[model samples]
Every structure is written in structure tokens, then in C-alpha cells.
Target: MSLVESPLLSIRNFYKKYGDGCLFCTTDSESENPYMDGNRCLECGTVWACRNLNFDLYQGEILGIVGESGSGKSTLVKSLFFNEEPTYGEMYLASYRDGEQNVFDCSHQTKRYLQNHELGMVDQNPYHGLRMDYSSGGNIAEKLIAADYSHVGQMVERAEELLEKVEIPVARMNEPPRKFSGGMQQRVQISKALANRPPLLLLGEITTGLDLSVQARVLDLIRTIQQELKVSMIVISHDLGVIRMLTDRTLVLNQGRIVENGLTDQIMEDPQHAYTQLLVHSLL
Candidate 1:
């Protein structure tokens, strides 16, 4: 289905569990309960990472996912990236498989191609998202390589273009990320993530560790990129401010379940769930 007619990406009844809660045995698992918290599972020494998560990301939408630590927001990102397989769920990208093929059922080769071309991720940790040892250009090149771009000059030119777009000096393309400040390192990561122009961009806590000033710049850069590229994005962050400023729609997860979902403005002004109310007030 076309993005205008259907979601660019859609997830239904998604679950990620661990230990005794493995996918095979989770048919009657308590983890499916929206109120089931980890402590409940931990008391029994199991882990229910995420439960019954359902959402839709419209084409070119910037959707925000917010929750406290251990709320499964990060787990959601991992599941989508295929870094951690879900116990059971169905995910579809209209850009691929007609939004009908179960992503989890895709073969390894197809999955790799999708990850490299259909999806891009800005990891929560710069170290995980970027190569510290590689020069800025090299880091960008790594992504290009995954997409099978082999022309050295063309890749370099594209790398410089992305760096410039992220406001990094093209001259510093040879500098290792280790020499850059935390903010600069994040910029490099953004440049690399966008190298292939993936249709869906997954952002994991992109601004958590930076100074206030740096965070503003990075968030601004993200906003600009989203507008210019018209890419749909799923942004995971605990900061309500981040969600308010960047996201058009918001999902509030609590203990692995989505407690609230609506337009960012509505959620902020009149949070429905108790947990979400507390979360919104704490930001005041």
C-alpha cells in the first residue's frame, strides 16, 4: 500500500521476552499483560521486555516513544533494528514486502539488505553507532559500503555532502571521532546514519548525554533532516522535552505497555494514564 494510503511502517501485538518467557513458551505467558512489569517477571526470574506494542508510523512522520528506564522503549528500538529478535510479533514496512511480509520471517540476506537500505539507526551510544577509530568520512563510507557503493570518489563526495549537511566541517572528514567532542561525535553518527537515505530512521536517545547547547544543535539538525528528507522516524527518548519539540505524535510506554498514544500536544496537555500524568507533571 502507498504511504499516503497506509502507514509507512506498522507494528501489531509485538512482544519481546526473555528466559522462561521465550517465544516458544509464551503462548499463555503473563508477559502479554499490559500491566506486567519486569519486577513481576524478575520475581520469577524471567524477563518480559515488551508486550503487545501496537503503533503506526505514517509516511514522513516523526513519532516519539517516551518512557522511563526499563520501560522497553530501548527494547522496542532493538527489536525493530533486528539486533534482538522479538519473542513474537508482526512488523511491516510499506517500502518493502508490501507491508505484508512478516519482517521476522525474512531470510538473513533479505534482512541485511533491508537494514542497509530500508532502515537507518542512530544508536543511543555513539560507540555502538559509530566507529571511533575510523575518520568521519570512513564512518560514513562504512554505511555506503553496506549498500554496495564501491566507487571511492563518489562515496567520498557523498560523505562530504552529508557531513556538510550535518554542519560538520568537510575538512575534518579525516579526523577520528575520538578527537571530537561528544556533540561532534553525535553529529558524525547522524551523518553516517543518513548516508543511505533510508525510508525509516530509528533514533535511540540521540540527545541524552550531550550538554544543553549541543543537544539543541543536534535536535535542530535532526528536525532539518526530517523536513528535508521527508523520512519517517521513530525517536526513542525519556526526555519529554525532546518528544514535545521534535515529535508530531507520542507514545508513552510504561512497564512494556503503551499507556498513552496521541498527538504530542494533546498528550502533553491532557495525559490520560496515571503514569503518563505523573510523567508529564514531573517535566513541569
Candidate 2:
């Protein structure tokens, strides 16, 4: 996990906005514009959800993105997962084309290829990540199918194995996620995300809305999976406690920009940015 090695994923000048820009709200001039409020353009009401995000996710590393609401933590991950299109950016994946091409500029089919084979996403809401009506095993089979899995027996076996990895009972594999508890639903989602054994996983607030005990179990599951599979992950959460438990490096975002980036322990010990300092103090 040396930083000197080439990154698994590299993002540069990434930006995502909700509305069309006005004369006073261009990305290059927004900082100097008098009509701008934080990440929003006061003149046009355009909200820049992510602004010039630049970061590298190294191989087999867990990178945490922590920020309060509206800090673009979720937006960054959504953009990476291709749930939201970026206004402009270059994303280079070492696993894709030897990191020579910008994925953003690639074709739609190529993006779909990346999504199916190279990436996995677990959204904060189970509704967003899972087909609640589908059986837990079916949900995982859906992902495996997308990755070209054809044998029903093998897919079922894989599903069972993944479910067990997240501590879900094999007997409940045929039950729909709608019938499961919140923690169980999240576990199923995690299993589905890992169905393809993707190298990069995007987890957006996966532990939110669960009980404290359930949260602990889910967090432990994530750690175990990372260690066992060596899958690089981008973990997005508003809670620093969750970040501290799961991340090796951390990014502190504010108003759509990354205000701080460093080792998780260092960021917790001595946060440099004012907003990050407030976050650390609040954690204490």
C-alpha cells in the first residue's frame, strides 16, 4: 500500500453540479465570484455537488471520505460509481487500459463494462442498492449474471458463500431482503456488491440507520472482507467514528471540496482545517 506505487484509481479535476452554470458560476471563477455562496451560485441557484475533487485510491487500501451533510462525500462516491455524471473530470483506473485513458471520456458501453466487472456499490439506503422483492440469493445472482455468470448452480453456490461471509444464514438465502432486518438488508447488499469479486468497492453510508450493535457487526464485516479479499474501497460516511474504524487514509470534505487529506489517525489527532478541527472536536 505504498503511496509511491501507481494508484488503483486516480481522479483529477472532478466536478459535478446540479444545474447549468451561469456567467457568475463557472468552475474556474467560482472562488472569486462575489455571487457565490459556498458551493452554490447565488446568481443562478446552481449547486456544485462536487468541486475539483482530486485523489488517489491505492491498491488494497480503505479510503474514508467523511463530512457532514452537503459536504459532497456521497456525491463523490455517486460520481465514482457512475450514478451521477460529472460536469467535467478525468478518472483513470489502473485496472483499465493500464491507466492510460480517462474513463469519463470513455463510451457509455465502456462505463457499463467497468460497472459490471470492475466496480461494486453499496448505497446508504437498501432500497437504492437492492431489489427488495428479489430473494437475497437472487439479488447476488443478478450481479453475477451481469458479470457473465451463466450456471445457476454455481451462482447459487457463490451467493451462499457470499451470504455466509457477511454472516447471513444460508437457509435465508431464498428470503427477500424486504423480509430481513435493517442489518440483514445491509449484509445482503454487501454480499451482492461482492458477488463479482470486484477490485474496487464504493460504500456510501452503509452503516447508517442501524442499531449500535448492528453497526458494530457490519463494520467488523467490512474490515474482515477488506483483509480477506484485499479489495480497495471508498467508504463514505458522516460519522468520524465509522471512518476511524474502517479507513487507512481519510478525506475531509466541506462545501463540495476536499479541505483535508491524510492518514486517518493523523487527521483525528491533529486536524489542520478549521472544519476538520470542528469535526474532530465533535468526535471527542
Q: Against the correct fold, how does model 2 do in TM-score?
A: 0.97
Summed backbone clashes in each candidate are: 0, 0
Per-residue lDDT tens digits of candidate 2, residues 1-284? 75579999999999989998888888485446688888899988999888888999999999999999998888788878887789999999999999999999888899989999999999999999999998999999999999999999999999999998998899999999999999999999999999999999999999999999999999999999999999999999999999999999999999988999999999999999999999999985
User: How well is each residue in 51-142 modelled by candidate 1, as lDDT tens digits?
Assistant: 88999999899999999999999999988988888888998989886888988788878888889998899998899998899898999999
Residue clash pairs of candidate 1 = none
lDDT agreement with native, every candidate? 0.88, 0.93
Candidate 1 backbone clash number: 0
Error of 2 at 160 (Å): 0.8
- The alpha-carbon RMSD values of the candidates against the true structure, listed in the order shown, are 2.7, 1.7
Q: Which regions of candidate 1 deviate over 4 angstroms?
A: 1-4, 22-39
